[model samples]
Target chain A: MPYIDIQNDLPGIRGLMAFSPHTAEPMGLLANALLHHSDGLLAAERELIAAHVSYLNDCFYCQHSHAEIACYYLDGDRQLVDQVRTGDDQAAISPKLKALLRVAAKVQQGGKAVQPADIELSRKEGATDKEIHDTVLIAAAFCMFNRYVDGLGATTPADLGSYPPRAKQVAENGYGPHIFSTSQPAGPSVKPL
Target chain B: MAHIDLPDLPGIRGLMAFSPETAGPLNELAEILLRDNANSLTRGERELIATYVSALNDCFFCSNVHGAMAGHYLQCDMEGIDRIKGDFASADIPAKLKSLLRIAGSVQKGGKYVTISQITDARTLGATDREIHDTVLIAAAFCMFNRYVDGLGTQAPPDRQYYINRASQRAAEGYLDFELYKYK
Candidate 1:
């Protein structure tokens, strides 16, 4: 149960957002820009970075949900998603992605944990400066998202079946629409200051 | 002198030079988070949250700059601020702020590490839901800010006065006014 009386059924940050729509707006906008935007980095790769960070943080809802999204972008390669989540070094992905994942891992540990050599390695692997920068931001932002979800004691769906459909919806429509959609019954609307 | 050739930049600005696109929104987010009055947390308390997380992350520049801002807002001397950073529990501060700092520490570690008891303790000590919410966001945001500064190996000034001066300017002028580098 959440520390506060949020909707019992709404999973992860969705319930928390419903509880505090004020903060949710900006948070959702940030997510849309970071994960869904058509930037230099592909959406799948960005979702992979998010999933990897959530995996490092052991945020079950984030890791699983983003992995589903990543799989969708990667042609339904859930095995690759699992591999990246567990250990990207052993995962069969491009060296550039592997290097970026390394950078993301360092961000997960702490900012200072990332060293100059790491950036150099990523660059050597054909990672652009933009890709490297986005990787760091995605990793850093997920730290906030992961914490916000778990920190508020938001519910994590026990059923794996629940995530893929939601992931499809998010992949198609982005985060803004679903953030305020009341189709799913939420808890009493409270002001999230 | 950062990993990237950011001429004369120091602290977080140096790292942000690598990607100006993200920096715009991030700076906007900081302005709203630190200076906005939407929440009841005093700017001093919010700065203390940032400083405490920086200290935990061992980011010298963030700790010093934000610590100075925190001291400025709280009317605290350097010694008092240092004491709080070193050990907020025993520091001479209000019980409520101390409890909130404890929660911030947990956030710096990992979100899951924040236990229910801590939340309950903070509530018992009169920290409102907004205060708790803000504390978590501040701690979480600083983790990103600290990483962005140190991840790219930005240089920190050896002279503590650098941060003290910067703090006064930031407190007065605010974060939005900084002319950040555009690397597009």
Candidate 2:
């Protein structure tokens, strides 16, 4: 159960957002910009990085949700998603992506854990400065997201069946206003702060 | 410094050099987080939360800089701030603040590490729900800031006076008006 009264059926951060829509707006905007914006990295690659970080953090909801999105972008390659989650090094992905995943892992451990050589390897593998920066931000942001979901004691539903359909929606629609358009009214009345 | 050919900027400022466009919004978020008075937490308590998380992350610059800021606001000396950072539980502070620190520490480790019992403990100590909410955001934000500084291998000055000087300035002016690029 959530630490506070929240929508019990909604999974992970969705419940928390339902509890506070005011905060949800900015959070969704940031997610859309980071994961779905059509600029630096491909959406699938960004989702892969997010899933990898979620996997490392042991955030079940985030890992499953983003993994489903990754599979969608990867032409329904669920096995490839599983492989990336298990170990990016062994996964049959581009060398640049593997190098980028290494940087993301370092960000997961701690910021200082990322060394100069890691950046060099990524650059050698054709990753740009922007890609590197986005990778770090994505990894760091997920740390906050994962903590928010679990810190509040939000539920991570055991049924994997629910995630794919939602992931398909999120993947197709992007994280916009519709993401928080739920039947449950915003609860607990978050005071403006 | 870590991997990229960044300009010779000092401290965390150097890391921002990699993505100058992000520096503005990132600094804006910091301003809202640390300087804005919309939340229930006092400026001193908020700064302490940032310092505590920075210390936990082992980011030397952030810990020292925010530690100085925390001391300035609390009217405490370095020794007091050091005591709080060393072991907030035993520090000469209120019980409620200590409970919040406990929550911040749990966030530093991982989100799932925080438990319902911890929330209950905080509530028992007279912490309002908004206080708990702000504490979690502060802890989460510091994780990002700490990573941004340390992830790029930005160099932290060794002299404590460097941070003390910057802290005095930041406390007086806040984070908004300050120029981030000139330091390079």
Candidate 3:
């Protein structure tokens, strides 16, 4: 179904890292900070940004994966995740997050899409400078991530349950341990030029 | 400086879901997914993928914000976020990430830009299906996000501190508690 070959099974980035332990380190570090680090954006909001962006990009893997994690923090409400995916602004989210999502949506369309009023509105909603900045960052980072998966034609799990535990682990442990999965390689790793 | 106008803040979508109390439910759900959802990708790497794509897309807000996030995850020795934005190929990152970045690049160009061999190459460098999947999603999503921001012409704060301080809080409290502004 994908454009390329990917392993049938194996955790998220873990299998890829296993293919090349050395090369996976930096990614692991990035994951460590973005997901687990204390100073970075909250894991839930990060996932929301990821999910929202994935929805916009039509990246199935990201959409499904983050959707499940979102449910976990949403008191196990899957419908809410679905609502966000649909871009239903009236999806019962907070004004702040709604504003942030608007910014994220704008960012997904392109950075230039975000207007000055958006910033003022976010500020009015108590979205601090860092939150606004991170919202944009979250949108931007997910774009690269979306392309990486879709670009390579990597394996995407049919089962939504497959991603949450992994997400939780990455949230807790970081990327170092799973870079080079001890298991056999299941997917291709496209090297960046 | 942006190419587009930021869509109505609290426009149709938010207005439809009016009331901060009512909106709390959605924010709570989003918060869990954004910050709490765990994955194999390290915080820095995920943020790096985000930052790299932002740079590629030329979304200044995302590039700077996520760059700082990636920097937060890195150790004292590495350039971290700078390397990702400056030159992913030579950023002292792992071979797989380099490979992943390639995939990310292709996504930036277009989904069709990614090739089978690229996947193999990334696998050769130790990438998993989930990692690859996440990469694609991140790249693809960022494209939309970049467009959203750029498309709407959202404002970028004048100072880096604005981004840094806010980012730290979002990093700490998640999205639910951070809601500060409200509209009639």
TM-score of chain A of each: 0.91, 0.91, 0.78
TM-score of model 3 vs. true structure: 0.51
Residue pairs with backbone atoms closer than 3 Å in model 2 (clashes): A116-B2
Cα lDDT, all candidates: 0.80, 0.80, 0.60
> Tens digits of per-residue lDDT for model 2 on A1-193?
7777764467778877776665566567667767986477899999999999999989888998898888878887888898887664678889999999999999999998998888999999998887887888888878878877777777886767667777777888888557657442222321211
DockQ score of each predicted structure, in the order shown:
0.56, 0.57, 0.21
Candidate 1: tens digits of C-alpha lDDT, residues B1-70: 4655565667777655665656666776677777777878889999998999999999898899889899
**Which of the two candidates, 1 or 2, achieves a greater lDDT against the reference?**
2
The 10-residue segment of model 2 chain B with minimum total lDDT is B20-29
Best-matching candidate per lDDT: 2
Better of 2 and 3 by TM-score: 2
TM-score of chain B of each: 0.92, 0.93, 0.76
Q: Write model 3 residue lDDT over B124-152, tens digit each, in one string.
A: 88888767766776666567555544543
Model 1 agreement with the true structure over A102-121: per-residue lDDT tens digits: 99999888887888888899
